[model samples]
Target: MVTNRLWRTLSAFNCSTRRWAPIPLRNTQSQVTQRLSPTSRKIDTLWTQRLSIISWNIDAFSSRPVSRAKLILSHILEGPKSPDILFLQEVTPDVRASLLDDARVRAAFLVTDAEDQTSFEDVPFATMTLLSSARFAFGLDSQKESDGIEGGENFMLGRISRVALPSKYRRDALYVDIIPPTAPGTFFRLINVHLDSLGDTLHYRTHQMEILANVLREPGCSGGVIAGDFNAISPEDDGLVNKNGLVDAWVALHGGADPDGATWGVGVERRNGLGPGRLDKIAMMGLKAKEMEVLRPGPIEVPRPGEEPVEIPWSDHCGLRCTFTI
Candidate 1:
């Protein structure tokens, strides 16, 4: 059986050596508490707890990936308040290594991919989810089971699961069953996905969405949130949410067709004639969006050791951050 102390070892994958290494632990109590700001702490006292999520496609394929990854991590971690969950896509091996090795990241969140790296090794890049350990406890194996296991204050109960979507590109979705602190004996699914890209691969994305929709409607699921890069480049992409019986967090907070809702191709020059579009999104069922914003709106110049500093948007795509209540 996995003990509470065993979870604290926090094993990380070594991309260079292709081995798993134990990440050194720190004073997790202090580190975890420091991540939340005063306002965030106060907000926690309310009867209904809100879930904050940030979904970004870090664009691992972009130039200076290592440097870009560092910058992206800094921006996300150094923010005034940490998000409850993070859904990142286009994460290359090196990027994944950097994230797992960071002490702050290790202390603050439970990574979905850390324990099962081999399942995704065949893919060039994969999507990753970070669940805030401070706020949530994993559910039992069966959603019909009672509230999370009771033991160490920080012990997470069950495990997270992933589904391989039908994609020519081998894309898949990572999901976790989390018991909300305010609501016991019930759990909601949180999914991280990066659908097939490009304008010609619409059918692949459509099929992937259908499969995810069914997962949300599963017998014991209490409703869930799906967030990540949808690559919604076409007009038909708008209908996927409604057709699947899901609510778009962006549209729920701000109205439809809002220019500010655009999340991709911003501050970056595209070879195609297409302008920026809202490709990354947070879609949900049985949850209400209370606040939403575009993360890392502008570009930054990343300094290269010998070469001139290269200017690029945080990623080819801007990130989407939203807060939802159950």
Candidate 2:
């Protein structure tokens, strides 16, 4: 339960800024079509505009950070089909640098959090989001002249804001407003979050979810999607989606929690001897989940300083990819 003290603390740290600065890359790809056109010929067609997203915790504290980061990036960017939006948690400075420096990544997405600025100074790891550059440009161009003047806020190009959550771990939620190409003035929020970890911090995670849920329900927000590492090790964490008025993408697509949907503890050995649990998830409001699948990139052989190479999973946790319709 969130108390008055927690609310006051959250208010103090609710500062926002435009973090979605575009990388100076030429758009060589074909322009993306308007998926959520409000004036469609058929109302049922509105539910078929698919937006694919991927969320993963990259395990910053793992060994061979550079190798792990490279492997992860290759699997995501060089895959058969790239997702429209990406949410990555537990990213260290090295991992962040690698991501920004990749030519393929630079050519594809408009990323949040530049390499120069430390978004989470107090913590060793931070969350990062990447939006399709073509789609972003489409949204910017589709904005009407009157839309930018509403509430003295410019909706052009959209915006990214960070909300500091009340946590000893210095975790925060990163929000990005995405303008639907067909909807001139309407937009949906995409949130990347890493909630409090460990079993004893249930109260803190609950409070954090409450704050994020309110952000999703705020005025002017059409709908939103929240994805990242929840660190859900206890039973109480299961009810968070329903309690917060958010639908779990995995459950919504599968009808219930599938045992094979577990995202953590399966790839790597845990010192605490804990088994696998679904620590990472995608939750949404005002969006329909069409498909959801776990991304297990498996392992890569890393050469040691003075020994033979050994195989290891890119991260301790697997990633999730989901397709949603507005």
Candidate 3:
């Protein structure tokens, strides 16, 4: 496969970014007092008890990944107001390496890779990456019932299951159990995936969807969240969803809203390499969404004036995150 000269060149530059490490999920949390706020709004416990779920395809952390990490820190993980769970798809081995070695990303998340690294030289492919902050516990197997995660005020990292799919790229769905602070005795099941990207065909994707739907239909999936870059438009995705009774967080919150919001396609159709469609998503079986928004890579204004721009994002797809009321 041919690599993009621009990306190849930019990847060579030394990249660095900072982020908050995972804070352990304690059983108790302060009450949230509000209803709706801005997309970049900090976690306000005064509003109401809610769970923040961020699902992004992330364009394989293409160029200026540090900038993207900063955007995430500023917009999603804002210290005490950070998200409870994070689901990311298309996190390639190189991207994983960047996050592992980068100071910025380490400050924010205690990540659990779905596939364990065997050889140091092996390059991980497109994978469903599951990570977390201080808001929840990690490292245990996903269960249908409440299997209390082991964590204190600061022990949130845990084990994750790598469930594979029947696709040409050998894709997989990652599973992690989380305890949302708001609802007591409830273990939130989080699944992240990147469906077949070989092309717009229903054959392989159909089998993959069947497998995904079955997972969602598991007995212990009441507070389950299934999210990622579905590559779902070609199949209309509804039949499978309806079959499993999963609710689309975007559509549930919007309901014929934001017609122009496209995660993967955006402007690629006019240029016509990928598409102009909404490809990324967050779905759930029993969780309620308080807010959902599509996150894009725009400019971040530096403090000093009359200086060259410090960071620029060139990812092919945009990002999306949703805050759910538990």
Candidate 4:
């Protein structure tokens, strides 16, 4: 292989002799190119083929009335590229307009409200987006009796009228399966859930857990991932959630330990500090975890004249992400 001029220049900048021995620039370039050439090619090939899933909880529409989920969406796009499959929780129909206005994004989002007894939310004024004009299909997965675990009713997420779960949980979870444009028919399943609150008296959390396990075990649910505000600690802390066959993207990359040692300080009136509470999570069953991390930016408030911005009062939760290759 012929080395390019750029490589030669880079070689010169990196060339050096050791105090005992400075490494030569030629040596560095040759070593890096020899090692990175194949790796770069593999990376490029993977990017051209894989589908990524992202899971996040943008608090509630009420948190930041101006653009609650919008802010969270912006935060999700902080890095180089946006997630292809986004599993979002607490995405109320209250402000769907601001979210769909951007034509650059091919988004397929769903919203469900307890007050509505229909398949979709009763917000007729809400705009239905055309995420793609291609052959791609889209629909809601409302909790249903048919899709639930053997012992439970089928559950679906979204505003669709589907079989309902036997449980009387107030809100429903959402799911989005995206079929990539580049690779037709090749896709991934993304399940987003906000399990029952810790303070709730009902056994909804247990039931939800079972339902989730059942969903993953079902056939045809491959090349997928399940994530969102699990509302529970890591599987390491709770025997209830067995990592069995799935991989905890975050733990797999950052070690199965407390990656962020920050305390979940007592808020409102709760104090389940450092040890047993990591309410947010990202888990994968089939697709590989390329990269994963919890993004908790310091308070980002609205900017003032010559003053820095601070954290908005929109959400009380942090964003967790996992980039995967399918």
Evaluate model 4: give its TM-score: 0.57
lDDT of candidate 2 over 1-326, digit per residue (tens)? 11000000112122232222333322221211113222222222343367789998999886887788788878987898788888999988878777766666665566676635457566798888876653454233323332453332222345556667878687888777765555545568898989999988999899888777777665556777999999888889988988888999998888665788889987556788888899898999888898999988568787798999888788988999999887
lDDT score for residue 4 of model 3: 8
Output the TM-score of candidate 2.
0.79
If scored against the real structure, what TM-score would every candidate get? 0.79, 0.79, 0.65, 0.57
Look at candidate 1 and give me any clashing residue pairs: none
Q: What is the lDDT of residue 215 in candidate 1?
A: 70
- Top candidate when judged by lDDT against the true structure: 2
**Candidate 2 regions with alpha-carbon error over 4 angstroms:** 1-48, 138-156, 267-271, 303-308
lDDT of each: 0.69, 0.71, 0.53, 0.43
Write the candidate numbers in order of decreasing TM-score: 2, 1, 3, 4
Write one digit per residue (lDDT tens) for candidate 1, span 1-326.
11111122132333333333222222211111111111111212245657789888999776867678778778887888578888889988888778777777766566655644564577889887776756654433222222344432322333365556668888877766665544444557788889998988999888778777767665445677999999898889988988888999999888987898888877666677788899988999877899999986445687799999977776888888898886
Which candidate, 1 or 3, has the higher lDDT? Answer: 1
Residue-level lDDT tens digits of model 4 in 1-326 = 11111000112223232011111111111111111111111112343344455555556533354365566667765557565445555555554434434323322222222222232354222111111211222312222222343322211211121122223444344433444433332344455666655545235655565555555544333444667666664443344355334576776777656647222221323454444256766666655777766655334356666877545544556666666765
- Candidate 3, 154-227: lDDT as tens digits: 22232245554566766666666554443333344677777777455567666766566555444333346778
Ten residues in a row with the worst lDDT in model 3?
1-10
How many collisions between residues are there in candidate 3?
A: 26
